[model samples]
Each structure stands twice: as C-alpha cells, then as structure tokens.
Target: MPMDRRSVLKGASGIAAASTLSGCLGFLGGGGGGGNQGDAMLWHAMTESETETFEESLSIYNDENDAEIVAEENGDLRNNVETTLPTGDGPEMYRWAQDWAGNHYQRDFLYDASDDIDFNLEDTFSQAAVQAITVGADDAVVGLPVGGETVTLLYNKDMVDSPPETYAEMESTMEEYHDPSNGQYGLSHPIDAYFVSAWMHAFGGYYFQVNEDGEGVTGLDLDETKRGMEFVRDSIWPYVPADTNPGPQQAIFQNGSAPFAVNGPWSIATFEDNGINVGVTSFPTVDGNTPSPYTGTSMWYFTTRMADDEDRRESALDYAKWISQSEERQRAYADAHSDVPVLNSISAEDLGDQVAGFKGSYEGGIAMPNHPKMGSVWTPTEDAMNAVLQDDADIDSRFDEAAETVRSNWEE
Candidate 1:
C-alpha cells in the first residue's frame, strides 16, 4: 500500500483524469455475462464513496483489454460472500481490508493468489502496508493491494497559530479556546465503534494481544489500552456539547464551530473549502511511545467459488496484477484522490508540505484486527469507551471492566 493512507478520505479534488481511468479493459457494471464473455471479471465492494471509484476504475481497465469487466457495489462482503460464493454468483474479485483476509483464507474460501499473481510486495507496496495485511503463521499472500489510507490529525489554523505538539498542549489549548457559552466547542471527538478503536490505538491502546508465536491472541488488553481510553475520556469532553455526534460534529468541525477535530486526510477538503485554514499533524505521543492509530488497506481477493475454474481465475488474476503494478495507473489513481497508492513508486506531490508526520503513520500504523472475533468486541468496547468519555465512571475502573470483556471474547 502507499505511504499515506490518509489521502483516500480526501474528496477527489486532484484525481487524475477519470475519463482515462474508464479506458481500462474488462470492467463491467452488473455481474451476469456467461463464460463466453471475453475475460469478464466481477468485483464486489462496499457502498462507500470509494466504491464508485472502483467502478470508474473498471471502465479504465476494460479499455486496456478486449474483455468484459463488471464492478458491483455489493455492500458488506463479510455477510454476503457465503451465499454468493457457493452459488458461483460471487464476483471474480471482491474488495476487502487485510483484517478480514486471514479468517477467510483459513476457511479455504480465498485464493492462494501468490501462485498465479506476481506481486512485487517489496517494490509494488510499502513494507509496513504489506505487514498490515498478512496473516496466519506462514503469512501467505491472500490478495493484492487496491489502496491504503492512514489517519492524521486536522486542526484549524485560525484558532491556534501553532497547533499543539503534544497531548498536554492540545488539551490545554482546547480548554483555553472553549467558549460553550457562545456555543463554541473546542473539539469534536466522536465516540462510535469505527472511530473509537482508531483514537484508542492512536493513543497507544489496542483491543487484542497477539503473542510472538502469533497463535495465542487475546481481546482488549485493558492493562495496556486503558490509558488510551482514559485519555480520550478526559481530554475531549469539556470542549464538546452533548448533542454533537460524529457525523454532525464532523460537520461542525468543518464549519469552524470546533477548533480541533481528529480525522484522517480524507476530511481535509471539507475543512479547506469551508474557509478553514487547515494544518495536519501526526497523532500525538502519550508516554514514551505514540499511540498507534489503526490502519485500513483495501485489496482485491479472489474466491474459491471458482477454484476449479481455471480460465476466469486466470483472467481475474491477470487483471488484478496489471492494475496493481501499473505505476502510471496508481499515480493517476492518487492524482484523482489522496488515498495512498499500493505502488511504492507513487509521489508525495499531493501532500507536499501541508502534512507533517505522515511518513510515521505510513510506517507505524497497523491494520484493524481482521480476526473473526473482532466484530464481536465493538459493542462492548464502544459502550465502555463512551462511558469513560462522558465521565460517568473512574477511567481506571471503566477500562478495567472493558478489558475483562475483551479478554473473555477473544477466540484465538
């Protein structure tokens, strides 16, 4: 994956020519053509804004080859892959994050892509992005990188000439700037499942523990992660109002109602367009080490539903390798938007001098846990994390309780 994951979240301001991308060969819209269709490949992805991206990308890929390709916005692949695959109705390729790669690979539902695909992991992607996706004891290759996105801190320059460099400075700045009486909030921190884990890890806490052997892993390392949760609980509230939830507050932050907001580079344009002079920084360090904001990478994976069907698999494999390795294509893709390209050759021109400490995120960020058990912990974790943020209980005690729940839920 590319060095900066933060870029993907940015709106498509600088993206390369969408028309040129539509020229790619074999990308289709719907999934139903027969085997006779020249190298037709189907793709399944989420209904995210990014999904349209892959659809547009397919038009480009189809232009490259005399083949029929289709990309369907299938939403959550986790729940649908089963029925779709067994019926041979699954897409030839599916968009998935690295976290979900392992469990499916272990279930024998995913293809061992390494055999047919020549992925220059060393050359095509950054080393850290590679590690973030790999799994199992052997860490076999299960898929190819579609894109990589990172987390970055965004601040309003008008509020503070210089944004805080450390956690202490940030908190103090928020306190000084907060003016709830006039309806101004210093920060817009959200307490939801998708984001809670992100902030928690960035602050140096995590949900699970994996041993050196990589076999014994546990849930919610409260012992180590509690500090992160507490930090979130204590530092963000006074500056925020009760009614402002994630989506609305994010709007507030963009509109200048909040001076400080924690978000990825994807949200940069929103802040910029609203006349907010913006600055980007890495997530601040806590103790000796900076908290690890989680990383999420998108990839193309083939399903075993067509395991015995060699022709489509070969076509799918060929297409996957080509786009992934096309430095020109990847560059164009990034030029269209900021999501970090998997191709290592991509330039940092889009980011330039605005973002500091980005390389740190590209290097340090770890993928969200992909293990099956991961889905189960979000509810309890969010509840506990939310409780702490509202100051309902002692941070120490609340985190301790969350940790116990996480540990009990861990399967592997």
Candidate 2:
C-alpha cells in the first residue's frame, strides 16, 4: 500500500526487475517513444521464463487483433507509470501490483475498464483478486488480474521424502540435513520482513491494525509480534547461514547444497532447468496452523493516457481481454511459469501439481495491504528482524522500539 518502492525493497523483484530491465531494454536510453499510432506498448517486470511465456501469449492477441502488442521490460514500472502516465507516455498498459491499483486510481492515473472489457467480473476472478483491483464504492476495475505469487516451501525431493508439517519436524529435519562445512543449510531465506511475515502471522502477529473499512491501517501489534520474533531468534536463525542475503541463499539452493528453501514460483523454472527434483508445499505450521505468507497479485492496468487515443485504448483492452478472459492463454501462461492463475475459471487441477502446491500454500495467506500506511511498517520491522537475529540481541526492547517507530511513522 505504500506509494514507493522502499517498503517492498526486499521482495519487490518484479518491480525491481522492471527498473533494471528498463535500462537493459534501452527505455532508460530514451530510444522508445510513448505509445503511438501503430504499437500498443506494454511494460512488465516478469522473470525470464514468465516473460517468455507472456510474450508467446501476446502473439495470440497480436495475430488475432492485427495489432502489434509490444511488451518491453521496465525495471522501475511503478515509478515510471507514476511519472509518465500523466504526461501521456508510451505503455498503454503495464503489469503492476493489485494492491497498488487503488493508489493509482486515486491519482487518476488508471482507466476504469469496468465496461470496456467484456466479461463477468464476478464469474471470472477470485473475490480477492477482484477486490484488490477494484476501487471506491462503484468498484471500478483499475487493474486486470493475471496471476499471483506466494512464498512457499520448495524442498529438494531427493533430499526430503516429505514436507514437514510442524516446526519441530522442520527443526529435526534441518538438524539432519544442515551441514554448513560443505555449503549446506537446513533453511534458506533472507530474514527480512517480507519473508518473516509468514512466521509472524502464524504466531497471531500482524504488522498493522486494519480499520473497520479495511481500506486504512492503524498502529502496530507489538506483543504478538514479539512472540514471533522470539521464535525467529531462538529457532530459525541457527539453521540458516549467518550471511543469508537472498542472492547467496538462492545460490546455495541452486547448487543443491541446501535441500529446502522458501521462495515463490519464479524459482521453479530455475531449479527444474538445473535438473533438481523440486517439491513444493505450504509454509510449515507453527502451533497447529499454517503461517500466512503475503500474497502478491500481478495485474495489468489500462492507463488514462490511452483513453484519449481510442485506437490504442481499444487494442490495449483487447490484449487484456485476450490474456485474462481466454482460458487457453491463461492456462498456457500459468502452465509455462508454474504460477497460480488469478482466474477462478482456471482450476487447480489444470495448473499441474507444482503450481497447485503453491495455490494450496496461499490459501492461508493474506493479500499484502495496498494502503499507503503499509509503507510505515516495513523499514522498522525489517530493522527489528535484523537486530533480533544478532547474538547480543534484546528481543522485547528491540521490538518495542520498532513498534514505537511504526506508531511514530503513522502519527507523522
């Protein structure tokens, strides 16, 4: 819900990739013009395989509509959209966060495709996806739902026979497999707010208090959060590397040195390409319940600038309709990336075992809050997480300080 990237720094790979890819794709070099007469431009930050899948799917739309649907990689898409849309920039449509749709709507940067795209909104996507993309009382559609990603347990099947159901089992398994000398560890994940939220939520902790309207956020939940923090300090830290940045953890997992990891579907192709037998399942349970990981929905928005150019707007809507409404294109995209399609019409059975595992993992998860207030919690929480993992840490005091910081940020 934050208006900027800092809040989502650690986990905003799709957005981050867009910023980097924008440069690589020469958009930063000022080569491509804002969308013109012939091309209906799209900018997305999808991973390599997802990009490949999406581009192939675009071919279907392009051929049928007699349109050139060009999807270029943009690393800083959210920011780029913010700066350029009002100025009538190129991308008639671009992929972005479902949660951020409201922010864009409030800024009047997005076009409401509620009537333009021909489909039963209620019958197509899950209620959550619909809710994420809708804004205000009339609930206009600011974003078209594509697919979503959730953090789940990805274990090397040849290393672990079955996924552990409880934290105790996971600990024992970690102890069994974790041999750091040969570049192996029980678990691999950056101990940041985005990744740790799963453990916290399972312990009945939350980042912010949601208001009655559910559109706003209030103060922090410090006490329950401390309980989760205690587990992180006493349990998870010992099993992971001392320097567990995301890059190294992924490298360790890719090397097959570590059997278990907590990641999204983005890594599935990489592991498979490396010939590792990967197994997917829900995040391990704490107490008797599965911890809720944050779910990030990928959505495409029709820009307001496109509305003036009727031709491009029609083409953009057609492209959105083709990918989102067409079962064949949706299934192909989902199958290609092993991702959970946001469309309710696409059954889990059709998504194969691996993607279905991610879907099952996400059932307990909460959608990441889209409100601007969410921005206040991330930095303080991430700092607290890092501090608590230290050897000379004071858990309660650190958490209390962090909670106070969030409260202060909210007050500001």
Tens-digit per-residue lDDT, 155-212, candidate 2: 8898889998888888888898898897789887666777777887777778764566
Off by over 4 Å in 2: 1-32, 67-70, 115-120, 136-138, 181-183, 309-312
lDDT of 1 by residue, 184-212 (tens): 77886554544445456754457664568
**Candidate 1 regions with alpha-carbon error over 4 angstroms:** 1-38, 46-56, 75-78, 193-199, 202-204, 219-221, 347-360, 410-412
TM-score for each predicted model, relative to the true structure: 0.80, 0.85
RMSD of 2: 4.1
Give the CA lDDT, 0 to 100, for residue 238 in model 2: 80
| Model 1: per-residue Cα lDDT at residue 378 | 64
Angstrom error at residue 340, model 2: 1.5
Lowest-scoring 10 consecutive residues by lDDT in candidate 2? Answer: 21-30
Best by TM-score: 2
lDDT for each candidate structure: 0.59, 0.70
